[model samples]
Target: MTSTAPAQEWPADVRTLAIDVGGSGFKAAILDPAGAMLTERVRVETPYPCPPERLMSSVVDLTQDLGHRDRVSVGFPGLVRNGKVRNIPSLSRTAYDGDTDPALEDAWRGFDLAGALTEAFGVPTKVANDADVQGCAVVSGEGFEFVMTLGTGVGTALFLDGRLLPHIEGGHAPFRKGDTFEEQLGNVARKQIGNERWARRVVEAITAYDRFLFFDTIHVGGGNAKHLDPADLPHKARIVANTAGIIGGVRLWDLDA
Candidate 1:
């Protein structure tokens, strides 16, 4: 559903809405296209089997009550190709997995999210993987950079040559001891090890990752990121807020084609 309509331009002063969708929760921000927060961020529980219609309606409802905006950017938790979910491998185990949840199944999968959002809001919308969009916000137009989001699951996204590469799915990639990296480094791992141990693991993981990618920089974000004390980290690494979703959403204006 990639649009051929004249590329929509975001108004200089118009506020834009940014959303980051996860399997367990959703976060939204109302801001200028530059990612500046204009209103307090809003979050809602993401019960699995949430029908796409219901989810969209919820967003519309929230925005309508919160106030309307000119653009909407969504960071979805799946492999989005041309604004459609090709495979939701990471989110497949959630409540909506089989579309078995009677309250909402048809609306979750096989829906043209960007298109539906446009129809719902009468404004342009752009969608991408949550981790990918988070990574996009980290790149500083210099060299390769990556982001590892430590939340319900670990998510990794790589940016190369300044353009965002879609659907990297680095979290599911196998790591040591027959476990996926996400399982080892994700929030699940934190719970297994407790906070103090989890922090140590994060340091070691980051050090190894730096060596593996030979990356110029690494950014750590997500809910758990705030818990990480900067003094505990090795070397100089940039730490950013999860709010990158808004800035990355603004980049959609540049991506419209």
Candidate 2:
């Protein structure tokens, strides 16, 4: 996202409900116009076979006790364009480690998540890829910046001079051993391989990513990011807090985030 328009000004009274949808859980919090948390974060375990309707209800349930929200911002794990969903690796599965469900796959295609949430909340809503939303919180507005979020699956986002580039599901791209990045580096892979080996794989993945993109810095976030040891990663790489998903929600309204 790049901005040509002037910055938007939210009235001090506006409260934003920011939701972070992950494979393992759904988390949300109310944010002041300035992005400070206005209420303690609320969370719910994400149910398996989570079709769009179920996911929508989960989001609504999170805000039941948080009072009124002037708008909504969502960080979705799937590929979203124009507020619609595309590929849904996490949500398409029947179980956490199960194979994709064809029925779920068809249901998610072009689902209007932003529109649905807008109507549900009775407010304007914006949705973007989870990694893109997380990247919005961490980028330095310098040269090329990249974010890699390791969760149930992997998520990727890119930015240049503070402007977001288009989204890419880089984790699904080929890596080695006839496996893709998500196949080799996701949470399931980490459990199968152990953190020691997973850390090694992470370094290797970052190295390969650097070779391909040569980012100014690679910020790693998501639930699984804590497993990595900074000493093993390239000097330019840094691990960021998982809370960025919620903290970055306010930026979603900005023209360039």
Candidate 3:
């Protein structure tokens, strides 16, 4: 199919909710299909012993507060196939780090997240990987695009032909022999280098990533993107912030089509 650029105006009648779920926190916003934020984005710390029931309940509480949004989009940190989380280890490190919480089980290994949200909210829900959704917000399919997010852990997602594919754990991808990219460039790296030094190193890292991937554009976003200084960047890349949920939510249809 020939791809069109994202619309400047969103469909007016559809009200949608977009949620970002991470290892540590959750961020969400209610928006009109036109991509206008209708309510302030709300965030809460993700519960430590994240049983699926509890996680699902947190979402219910958030939507109930919104009252009547008709559509919902959720961004999960793990590998999502047909709205089901296939790998918890990639999404929640604490759950898989061999510190098995009594509350979790293998049954949750691949649960239908879309159906759960639909059942709870009484509205159709579309779910995609958090990194993939973030990539949708910043990359418009103009060329080869790679997005890197530095948050609780490093996240990587790619966008091609105006479509958001499944996320890649580039952070978990091996970097120097045995160490993963996340270990090198993730926020944990912040402790080793102060913000300024980290920014400089980010510049170097992005330059290397660009050259390696031959990417025409590199888009960076995440909780930590705000802490970076554009002046220290090494290449010509767009620094995007503030509108990640809005732009990313617009691509929620990818879950079905």
Question: Which one is best on TM-score?
Answer: 2
Which 10-residue span in candidate 2 carries the lowest summed lDDT? 1-10
Q: Give TM-scores for every candidate, taking all chains together and pairing residue i with residue i.
A: 0.84, 0.95, 0.84
Question: Which lDDT values do the candidates have, in the order given?
Answer: 0.70, 0.87, 0.68
Per-residue accuracy of model 2 over 1-257 as CA lDDT, tens digit each:
22222356667788888889999999999998777899999999999889999998888877889988877888999898877888989999999889999999999998888878888888778888899989888889899999999999999999898888999999999998999999999889899989999999999999999898989999999999999887778999999999898878887787443
Q: Which residue pairs in model 1 clash with each other?
A: 52-107
lDDT of 1 at 130: 81
Cα displacement (angstroms), candidate 1, residue 125, comes to 0.7
Put down candidate 1 lDDT per residue, 145-196, tens digits, no spaces.
7778887777777767666655577777766688877778766578778889
Model 3, global lDDT: 0.68
TM-score-superior candidate, 2 or 3: 2
Error in Å for residue 4 of model 3: 24
Question: Model 3 Cα displacement at 235 (Å)?
Answer: 2.1
Q: Distance from true position, residue 226, model 2, in Å?
A: 0.8
